[model samples]
Target: MDRFELFHLGWDDLWASQLAESSHAGRLGRISRVERGECDVLIEMGRVRAQSDSQRAQSAVAPVTGDWVTVTENDDGESMIEMVLERRTELVRRDPGERETQQPLSANVDVVFLVHGFDRPFRAGKLERFLVLAWNAGATPVVVLTKSDLARSEQRNELPAVVAAVAPGVEVVVSSIESREGLDRIEELLTPHRTGTMLGESGAGKSSLVNALLNTEVQETQEVRRSDAKGRHTTITRDLLVLPGSGILIDTPGIRAVGLWDAQDALENVFSDILDTAADCKFRDCAHDAEPACAVRDAVEDDRIDFRRLERFRAMAAELHESEQRVIERDRSSRSGRSHNGGKRRR
Candidate 1:
């Protein structure tokens, strides 16, 4: 394979420019998988194992699957990742635990499948959060409702309409691995050279969907709890695989919590109906809760919109506000500490 053809792996002129500063002898490759600062990169020559210095990788940026990086050979002839090219797009969420930081999930993605299963209770609020996360990543968000075979006919029919209401301007595809449904639509989204990732909770049939797409049992699958329909964490690591004759796909570990990180604009975009309704309220800052002349409340009262969805939208708005405040406080504290340390040094 020619070196230039390597660009088919989501590389572009932007990446080429970013790599120009690095050693001219380095080869460009996309990270297929990353584990403990070690990477499996796909280059023009094929797959190669490259080691990334943990300290340096952390200092620059931890490599994630789908990241295009430049690899160089050391004196020992071992491949080492020298630099991570700038990502055209990346999915990031609030860091898990007590830290107020952003955790990048994947980079340079074109489409994001926000998978949810009918086997479990479908929470519009949670799905809205996932949509915001995908939109915030600068990638097109497509809602994938899986396990359709488990749902009754009425539910199976209504679920798509309900999801479509919440996710305006986004595609909602239903899939049932048991019956081989919606696989074609999924394949349609995976255009050549385009990179996509699946983000969903456990038991959402992400692994099963990928397996169906590849026409092979490449990813392991497990059954969810019989009583609750909650699935165990099957895919623990994020892996990027190239489709046999199509685009690249990345399957990520199930995320238990969906936290919003600087996604205010995305929140507005997701709940645009509510925002538009709120605009007609008498009070400019109507909370839409028992406030007189509130168009949003009126719509709910008149059954123009589902009350549950309106409530969920309000809750997400509150969460976004709180997240923004926390980020502000954290930044202020960091600046204060820096100023104090600088003063001590002057003394």
Candidate 2:
């Protein structure tokens, strides 16, 4: 296979120049999986396990799955990562309850599948929160409603409308791995060389979906408890799986809490339609509360928008803004501490 073909460069030619900055003079490899301090990389030569050396360590750059990196071999036959290429996209989330750090989920992804189970009715606020992170990752968000077969017949009928209310223009698919329904549609999105990440709460059928796509029991699946309907976390670490026929998929462990950090743009984009409607309001910064001539409130009153959905959006937006402020405050304190220590050392 040619270098481009072996490296899975389908439409990512723009990244070629950025990937050439390594010590190897641009010999590139794709990161398939990362564990602790090492990674499994796929290059033109084939799959090789490698780690970052001291020079790359100085940069504090952590390589996640799907990242293209430059690799070199030592006399001892150990390959080391010299540098990481600029990512086209990166999925990041605020460390849960810790506003000090950003957790990178994946890099260079083309799409994100926000999975949710029908056993528990979809929560508009939670969906909005996930979408914020997805949009911030620079990947298109597609909502996947899993476990459709578990829903009551009447409840299943209302699924489409519920999805439509929360996310407009975002593709929503109802899937049931047992019945194999909607698998083809999901497969179509996994075009060759494209990468996607799965995001959802624990037991939302993410693993089951991966198993279905691979057509094997690659990922373990367990039944949700009848009493609580919660799934056990079968996937302990994030693993990247290459589809036999097409693109790659990053399977992440179940996320219990998805805190937001610096996602103001994403939140605004998610609520753009409502913001557009609010432009006609009397005040420039209308809160959409009981303000006079409030277009958003009027729309809610006239049944143009669901009141619950609007309320959820407002609450999530506020929560994300608050979280961002906390992160900024934490950074300021850290900088102050560093400056104080430096002055003491000089004295």
Candidate 3:
């Protein structure tokens, strides 16, 4: 198979000049998995483990799964990455407690599966948060509702409406690994070579869903404890898994908290409906609080919008702004510390 075929590179026009140039030069491949600091790259030459260039490290450009890169072969049967082709999409989040550093989750992802557990119902705010990250990544977001079999019949009835309210123009699949339901729908989304990552809280059945897709127990699965409905963090790190018959899947360590970073645009996109309503408010810069003729407030009072959902949106927007400020301060401190150390050395 051609390298593109192996990497699931459909839509040839979307591949940028740098990626095409590397491919034409016969040095391009897709990163399947990143382990420790080494990468497992898939090329026309086949899968090989390669180290990233030390020069790239100086720029904070680390390779993650789905990154198309150039690799060089060494005499010792080892390979080293020479360059990272520009990515079409990048999944990132604010590093917890550190705002300035953007933690890259994956790169060049075509789709993001935001998994939620039925047992937990749905947190509208959390769903919106994930959607913002997905939108920012430039990948289409699909909601995967897991543990459907475990949900009470009434809760099941409420699932669709909840999803529709938060994720407009997005697809939602109700799945149950215990019964193998919705597996085919999920499989259809997996085209060979295209990459996707699973995002959700621990015990949301992310690993279980991946295992179901692969049709094997490739990942270790554990039950959520009864006391907290939280699963033990079985998957300690992010790793890419090649499905037996379909596309590549990047399974991430169960995330307990998903901090936001510079997601203002994303938040606007996710809540565009609310924004649209607010646009016609009496005040151009209205905070939507006690403002006369506020469309958003009107909607809330008329039951046209869920007040709780609106509150969630406002809270997330504020949180993201605060996180960005924190990141800025942290970066400033880091630079100051470095300068101080340099002065001491000179003295």
Candidate 4:
């Protein structure tokens, strides 16, 4: 194994220790792209196609791009992913097809770029949801507003402040491929040995940003529709690329359906002002809706919190509660079915 590739790909002693403890006797490789039945894994010998039967492996989820896995050869001499090392961080969202299932987007992600374009109206709900996703993954989130050349002068000066209000304490960088504004700031966020990925809907200029960061036009670029400013899905799969003299970057397909899974603490992080104000509420479990002595409501009246933002937070919290209830019910039913298979124990 070349020592440089390990560190270059963000592998360290922690991952080394995990590989040492694995029962499978094979080398470590990172999954660059996950296909239907196979994965493109980067090993010392370079990228190779390996069959994946790892959905039931130790990780218990199908390996996604950026997962460091153990690759072993089978009796037929075909490389197989025997196990996926315990992940350090994972970008996850609820499966669009399954109600209660979680879909792991990327494994071991260090930074998540929440890309948006100035061509379209700013969507705070989408930004908040993406923030929750990044926070839940234990990754730093950066709001990258692209197409600076096209933004009106007011948007250039005033839009960033508006975005800053939505993403408090998160870095917001305005970038343009033509003008090359704020590109250096975005590049500096990813130091060597870190892995970052971008998330946004179609026509958000995510791939263009990736091309800029890579210093070459590797990703295909497209123009958005004039009427709606919506772009087609140009980038289809997720692939990891090492930046020149910098860190590793994983580019993913446009994510239009960003269904949040289990993200209570992350949601709190997104609306930290609300969380802090709720701390002073008269009741510990105050819902802040018409509740007497509600510090949150008081703050809204005092202009400390925007009423619309408060309403959005309330709606998201209610949705999260519903999701929790569904999870508990599903777990109880699964347990009941298991007990019927001769392992029944009466309380």
| Number of the top lDDT candidate | 4
Candidate 3 lands at a TM-score of 0.86
Q: What is the lDDT ranking, best to worst?
A: 4, 1, 2, 3
The CA lDDT at 142 in model 4 is: 95
lDDT (Cα, tens digit) per residue for candidate 3, span 1-347: 32435435332454655565554333667787788889988776667789875645588478988787778866676678878777789999987755567888889888899988887746777788889999999998999999989988988888877798778888999999988888887777877456778889888998898898888998888989897678788876666677766677888777766877777888899999889988889999887788788999999999977888889888887888787777688889999999999999999
lDDT of 2 by residue, 102-166 (tens): 77878888989999998875777888888899999999999988988888998888887787778
Error of 1 at 81 (Å): 1.7
**Over 4 Å off in model 3, which ranges?**
1-5, 8-17, 22-26, 74-77, 324-347
CA lDDT of each prediction against the hidden true structure: 0.85, 0.80, 0.80, 0.87
> Model 3 scores what on Cα lDDT?
0.80
In candidate 1, what are the lDDT values of residues 114-204, reduced to their tens digit? Answer: 9999988888777888899999999999999898888999999998998888798899998988898998888789876789999899878
The residue-by-residue lDDT of candidate 4 on 1-347, one tens digit each, is: 32237778888888888777768887678998988969988887777788896445554667899999888888889888878888889999988888788889999989999999999998888899999999999999999999999999988998889889989999998999998999888778878578999999899998888888888998888988999999899888998887777788888888776878899999999999999999999999999987799999999999999998998898888878888899899999998888786564653
Q: Provide the clashing-pair count of each candidate structure.
A: 0, 0, 4, 0
Clashes of 3: 4
Q: Which runs of model 2 end up more than 4 angstroms from their true locations?
A: 1-11, 21-27, 334-347
**In model 3, what is the error at residue 175, expressed in angstroms?**
0.6
Cα distance off (Å), candidate 4, residue 110: 0.7
